[model samples]
Target: MICVTLGRGRHRTLLEEWGQAAEAGAELVELRIDCLRSEINLKRLLTDRRTPIVFTVRRGADGGLWRGNEEKRLLLLREAIVTGVEYVDLELDIAKSIPRFGKTKRIVSYHNFRETPADLDTIAEQAREANADVVKIATMAKSVADASRILEAAARSSEKVPTVGIAMGPLGVFTRVLGRKFGAPFTFAGFNPERIFAPGMLQFDELRRDYGYERINAQTEVYAVLGDPIAHSLSPAVHNAAFQKLGINAVYVPLLIPNGKLRDSLDLLSWLDIKGMSVTIPHKEAILPMLRQADGAVDRLKACNTVVIKDKVWTGHNTDYHAAMGVLEEAYGGATSDEVSVLMDKQVLILGAGGVARTIAYGLSRRGAGVAITNRDDERAARVAAEVGCRHISWAARASTPCDILINGTPVGMHPNVDESPVPPAAFRAGMVVFDTIYHPENTMFLKLARERECRTISGVDMFVRQAALQFTLFTGKNAPDDLMRQVVARKLGVTRD
Candidate 1:
């Protein structure tokens, strides 16, 4: 169940927002009376309301705006309870002072702004001792491990009392969605973006449609795309739609794994019994050494984008190789042999020396194409070129060198940097084909310049969708809905399909 929070400043606005929340399919609404500047008719607010309401007048220390005296705050809560509300939220500090109302469930909540303490069980036990009908444990998550600890605490505490566990922050978003699976009776979501009251809060529509909040169960398999700067990824929208289309009991979330923490994060995945994961950005190459076994594509590219855990062993695979190659083949459409021969003789220039650049270089080299690599860091560029048996072109000489195909393997013109281009506009020629690996901004500056020069262009959307489809197959052992994946990605990127 998704509980929508209403914290508008005016009573009239609050009532209006409540109706909106109800229309949005919210079964419950939380009214933060602390946000009101003046007193409201609590009886009128509850009258003729079909949805259940949870009344809360949070204080300043508890991350609320209530500035009244403790006596007045307690009076307000008591008044709300007498009005026949379904639930009353009280801080754990005042739980002992306030007696439970008849049939009005009491939720003793604890909010920690610092960190998830080492003794969560002890705190939860204290709430249970207070005779709370529901226990809410909310804490600031410093890392993925911190979120995991909170979930573990919830699973343990649920056996005693109904527990609502939440880890607040961007890193804690996974726990917010997966908390229900761990035994949370209901989870909270903002009715809209302007009404969000907590960090890492998602909208109800996103929770319901994109994350499969209502459909997720303890037995549902979990998969995710791991990256540091993951806000720009469309994997969740694309993969979740495919899961719904195929009726797969699975969910794909974005896991923000910071640098040097991959090894530690894998332990959490094992603990949660996550079925599989799709690696991205810096972790693509970093995850190779940690896997028990790897496919030939991963061995050849020296990178892994898909990891499937079977019988507690992790096997890595690289879908980017074939997915990328297939896109290039479609662009150079003709007979299969004719396309290969055309690619083999063409001079292909690739920019950047990261995991993606390495994958493209390896795949192109294996197809007998003459691949030249350049990067801002000469050492890394030389290393990738040497590994791929290709020549490393100096960055200063990229614009002057002529090539039939140019690929922006770097994230120069990705979202939020849409104005920046890796290659200069003057470098583009009339006949060259330009491809950028950044898919967030469908038509990047690099692609725009290529289009102006009458050069053929391919957006990164094709490669992203194709690779994710391949990862889906590896995760579920079912054929993915390719067209649905493409449609979802295009919609997410605000691109018009032909």
Candidate 2:
């Protein structure tokens, strides 16, 4: 069950949002009465309750806006309990002062915005001692270990008292989705996606639709996409949609693993029993040496974008190489046979010397395609060129050097940077193939300008969909629904069709 937290300044707005939450299939709604600007009218606000309510009056120290004194706040809380609200949240320190009244349940909670302390188990035990029907702990997670501690504590507490342990941030998002699996009664989410009352509070719709939270259980397998800036990733949306479509007992989540921390996080990831993962950006090349086994493509490119863990063996594969080659071959109507060499001897210039660019360069070179590499940082570009045995071009000379294909491996034309193109307008020529590896916006400015110049263009969406589909097959030993995958991504990207 997802508890939708509704905190509004006005009673009317709160009531309106409560109704909206109900329409959106909310089972429990938390009314943070502390957010009201005017005098509290408990009777008027609590009247006509559509769903069971968890009445909360949070103080400033606990990440709430209750500006009154402690006495007044306690009075409000006692009043709520006396009025027989379904539940009343009480801080661990103040829970004993107010005796239980009527049928209202007690939720003894602890909030620490600074960090998840070492004595989480002891703290939870203390909350349990407060006569709590449910023990709730919310803390900031500074590392993977911190998040793991929260989950472990929750699991232990659930054996005796129902617990909701949340590490409030991107790194700890797994706990929120996996709470039920660890015996948590439910997790908290906001009614509105834009209005966030707590740090890392998920939206109600996202929990129900994107994650399919209700289906997650102890037997459900876990998969995640790992990167530093993982919030923008569409992997969870696409993969979760596929899981629901195929009736697979699995949930895919986003994890924020900072650079140089992958090796340290292995134990925590293993503890969570993560069966598979989709690697991205900085981690792609760094994860190569850590893999127990890797495909030839991954070894050759020194990068791995897909991983499958079984029997403690970690194997890696490079879906980007195969996906890029597949799309390029399709664009040129190359012979079906791999031995025919469709891109044989074609001059290809790749932008950026990152993992994606390096992978494409090596793959093209193996297919008998002549490749040249260039970047704003000449040293990195020269390094990649030497590694692939290809020529290196200066960034300023990119447009002058003639090539049959131009690939934008850089992040220049990605979403939010949509107006910026890796190559100048003069670089695009008629009949040349232009490919940009940014998928959020299907028709990037790079692809749009290439079309205007009469150049054959390929949107990053093709490669993204193809690559994700390959990952899907590897994670689940079944063929992916390719059309459904494309539709899910298109819908998430807000793409409209004719």
Candidate 3:
């Protein structure tokens, strides 16, 4: 079941927001009365309810806004219960003091802001001993193992009473969606993406539309993209749309795996039966040691961006190399033999020395192109150049040397910073090729300046779509719907076809 949590200061029109949640298929609406600026009028909010309502007046100690005295808070909850609400959420500390009203079940809740305690079963037993009709536990997760503990606790305690367990943060998002499969009666979500009350609350539309929450069961397959700062990824949108189009019983989510935790995170993948994953950023190189088998491309590039799991073994592959080289070859199509030979020896200058930069440089060098690397930190640039058998150029001298192709492998022109460019406009020359690896702002400042100089330009969307299509094929063993994947990504990024 999906429960939409509503807090004050997030919505100007409370009733309208509640109505919209109901229309969006919310099974329950939780009204956080403590978040209100003034006293709530129970009759006004409770009348004509389309779905069951849960009244929660949480105190400040439990990560709530209620600052009033305990007596007044209990009185307010009692009044709400009298209004015929379906449930009243009472923290475990005050559960015994508050008298339950007829037909209004009490949900005894416990929250730990620091970490998941080792004595989780003892805590659930304590809530049950306090006469709770339902038990809810939410704890902050410092690692993926913390979330695994919470899921185990919830599954073990469900026989005693209906339970809701959540690991709160980006590191625990997988638990929030997988809770229901582990015997959780319901999972909570924010009314909308912008008005979230918890750290890792899923958006209502994402649970309903992207995950197909109602249809998800134990047999459904799970997939995710692992990275740090993964909130802005569009992979979920593209992959979920493909699954829906193909009628596959699978769900894809974003997993924020911090550095040094790839091995631990992969351990949980087998425990949870995750079928596939897309690796990005720092993890592309870090995940190689954890794989049981890898493709030839991964061995050549020393990086893997896609991993497929079967019979508890992980096989890694490099889709970025294929994607980058394919786009470059297509852009130089129909050229004369002399021009083609020039491309074979094209002077390619790359920005940044990260995973993506390494992949591009290796692919180009193998094709017999002369590649140069430049970065803000000259040491890192020299390291990458040495690894790829290319020359390292100082950042200050990048513009003095001319190149046939300039590629921005950095995140300078990514979303929310669309005006920033890694290279100066003077670096762009007429008839030169300029490419950026940021797909969100389809037109970055670098691309704009390159176009004005009459240089042939390519957006990162082409590379992103091609690589994602390859990952899809690897996961499903079927021909990917390339056209549909392009359309979904373009629509999400608000890029219109010319």
Candidate 4:
């Protein structure tokens, strides 16, 4: 079940939104009385409550907006309990003071905006000892390990008492979706996606539609995309949709593991029994060495974008290599029996010398295509070109260099930066095949220019879906719903094409 948190300054607005939340399929709502500008009118708000509510009167210290005295805050909590609110959220320090009354259950919660405390188990026990019917722990998670620690504590405490463990921020999203597996009764979500009720609080619709949170249970296998700056990833939506379509009992989430923290997160990810993961950005190459064993793609590209764990062993694979080759082949007029010979003698110019760039360069090089790499950082471009046995092209000379195909491995034309293009307009010649690996905006400025120049275009959507579909198969050992995966990604990206 998902609880929608509603915080409005006016009672009328609050009541209207409460009904709206119900209409939107909210099973529960949290009435944050602390946000009211006027005096509290418990009877007026509770009279015709449309859904079960977790009544909360928060103070500033606990990431709430209440600016009144503690005495008044405590009085409001007690009054709500006396008025028979379904649940009341009391902070750990004051949980003992609020006596349990009637049928109102006590949700003793702890909120630390700074960091997840080291003694989370001790805090959970304290909430339990304070007569909490449900213990809620919300803290700022600095790393994946911090989120893991909160999850571990919740799993342990739930065996004895019901516990809701949440680590705030993008890194902690897993806990909210996977908390039920650790025995949380229900997780909190914001009624409005645009509102900032709490850091990292997912909107009700997002949890329901994108994550399929209601379907998650202890038995549901967990998979996630791990990387830094993971906020824009559409992998979760794509994979989760495929899981639902294929009737696979699993959930995929986005985890922001910043650079230098991947090694530390390995044990924690294993501890959570994550069945698989999709690695992105900086970690792709970093993860290659950590794998117990890897496929030929990983060995050749020196990068691992997919990982499947079994019996505590992590096996890595590079789905990007195959996905890129497949899409490029199809765009180049379908694959042949000798796929490697298709691109032979063709000159390919690749933009950005990152992981994706490296993968494409190696694939093209292996297929006997002449490849040249260019980046804003000339040194990195030169280094990658040397590693892939490809020639280096200066950023200044990229547009003038003659090539039959253009591959954008950089994020230069991704969402929000949709107007930016790595290559100049003159670079796109007629009959050239242009491919942009940034999928968020299906038609990037780079692709648009290429189209205007009469070049055959391939958007990142095709590659992303193909790669994610491959990951789905690796995760479940089942043929992926390719059409469904493409549709989900296209719909989320607001594009009509596959």
Candidate 5:
């Protein structure tokens, strides 16, 4: 049986939307009092209660919209419990602050602001220590690998009670649809945008129809991407297509977690049923603290793109390194001898200073290429440069140097606003390399301008394919069909082949 959170926070949509959802055979209907603007008469609302009801007055402290301080919020939650609601959700922090309840069992939870926590046992212990009836953890996944870790940890947790594991992001969406497969009792869904508490949540219809329950299961391997602005990701198109082609039961989706909450997201995964996830920008460095063990490459990179929960412990790895290497090798076929050296000689200029840049920088360094990174985020660029041991360039010097391979690592070329390219054409050198990670529109202005100038170029599509293949390997524990994966990516990117 599956329960759907019909409306979020204090939304009045519950009376209509939740009732309709219940009519659709939804096993449970959640009334999120936290979203309501006025007091809810739970006693009056449950007069003809048909299904078991779960009531929550979510606090802003834990991924909710409620604004009341801890004391006031607790007063409301206790009122709901005393009013005879079947289950009441309590933020683990708030619940821990108060003494244990003698009668009501609380659904205690945590939310991540940065990235998913690296350990489930520790997360679950926190929830357990609070004496929560159902421990729920939700983290912001920076990549698909993060989603996998959330699900895998949920499946691995040793708990005396049921737990809800979730990755909150566009990349975490896959985990929402598939959480049940990993022994999770519930997966949150966004029925109305006005009421959505988390980011990149699928509408209830999309969840039941496009990403139906019959597909994902306990044996189904999972993967996803976690990023701040993930709506532009073609990962779903790539991974879902591969799953269909390979006759695999798995699927991919996105999750969005705002800053400072990735750890809470990982706590959700600790309720142990997920597989693994992909980590992304602004989170690779921030995610480091949560890992139990990061050996060899993972420790060396001090960054993680894939998190695996084996035996309830989350061990991190950096498959993005492989993905980055593949992207460089394929896009610049003779990367071994020609292009990289040329790029090194010319001091390749990179735009955007997020996780993608981090991996790409490392990849470029391995090729003996000197690099310069510049972005609007001065601090982020500096940090990324520090990680790659490259020179930090300023946005003011956009055209200061003739870049051999000027790469745009930002979201400037993505769709719905596809015309926007970060660097002006006047900045390009006739024989330079212009690489744009934007693949959906293979000929972004950045790439198109370079084409007109006869400059060498690479599309982010190559990187997407390679990273996805690495993800496929991580999820299925099988060697990926590299050629097949490339073709799939090419088709999705609308690249016409010779």
Candidate 6:
């Protein structure tokens, strides 16, 4: 439905313009009092409107021109509510402060004027708390990338709350078109240039006819990657691209679930008809206990990389285990017989024990590799080792003896930390193989030390591609276009293939 915003100081011409817009098929009027002088009256507009009205007195923090005092803002908002405008645009921050507003449906909003927040989960948390009729997030967008991040966040719980994503720049133009795909109820468009209310806003006709966005449907399938600081994920890009290629009508997105809400957040997928999800980062392990059931590698490894809902039942598995192992084995000279033997022996030294450890240990154990786990956090190292029935050693004890193979499962030697190897040169032995699971730097000090010792050395880039290839397979259910997937992952990771 069309809602023509009344410009500031346009009070003298409001009634006549409203009639013209209505005649042109605008369905309702939106009074943007934030753009108007304080003297312009909501009571007067309510008195004249035969059509319903939505009133908003947005603050400057929210990309609005409202420079008025907080007391004055609240006063105006209260007046609009008391007068009972059909809808009132209220910042979710202020709306949740009071027990209630008068009869109007509140279009509660969130805005990020700075660079997009690393976590969209926090934004969703704010919306969950606001309890508004709808939730809106406007992020200052510098590229289609930034816009996509916001659109992805809105996609996570569209059925729960009709969300709005306002991308405020030229790169943000795609937002209006993609908004519908993500269940965004409406997009902000400008009628004129100087008076353009938002950045990258287009005219309503342009949005309707040119962009071709439509109302969200109840049957649309949902999917997303849940994590904290989740704004930069490319699963939406990769998965959505795959969907378009395969002609799947499904949509995949990203959601920030904060640290504590992994269960409540992923539950949105089940409640909203989400068929599948791409889990990442901290959420990967945290989401383990939330699944209705987990089988296959997930049952043994106790880590799940993919969760699929069938007949409303959530089934989980760790595709990453085989993926990463396959990649590492393929890259490390097609995997030595000893490497194959280590998984069953429980004698391999794993230098890092984070999420990747889940895949590494699980994969190696399945292959009969004996694993030993260690980390900076001794307790965490112990936990991982105990779970896999591998022995644990302190970081200081790394030089004690040569294990069958030393795997760098941590990011100590990654790009920014390229100089920091988890294991020192003294930790290397001439006969042992070393695997540094840091893909970005290509080779870490650990791998270099192993190389200098004339020992077998392998890079982490292989493991990354292998894990991603598995995800690609699970996502498409077809053999991952191996060459294409490899190129895609290599190019994206700035790594070259074997």
- Candidate 6 versus truth, CA RMSD in Å, comes to 12.3
Question: Which is the leading candidate under TM-score?
Answer: 2
lDDT minimum window of 10 residues, candidate 4: 489-498
TM-score for each prediction?
Answer: 0.94, 0.96, 0.90, 0.95, 0.56, 0.56
The per-residue C-alpha lDDT of model 6 at residue 424 equals 67
What's the residue-level lDDT of 242 in candidate 3? 83
TM-score of 6: 0.56
Q: By TM-score, how accurate is candidate 3?
A: 0.90
Model 5 clashing-pair count: 64
What CA RMSD would candidate 4 show?
A: 2.2
What's the lDDT for all of these models? 0.86, 0.90, 0.84, 0.89, 0.69, 0.66
Arrange candidates, best lDDT first.
2, 4, 1, 3, 5, 6
Q: Write the residue-wise lDDT of candidate 5 on 401-420 in tens digits.
A: 66667888888977646778
Scored against the true structure, residue 261 in model 5 reaches a CA lDDT of 65
Backbone clashes in candidate 1 total 0
lDDT of 4 by residue, 224-255 (tens): 99998897688998899989998889999998
Native-to-model Cα distance after best TM-score fit, residue 4 in candidate 6, in Å: 21
Clashing pairs in 1: none
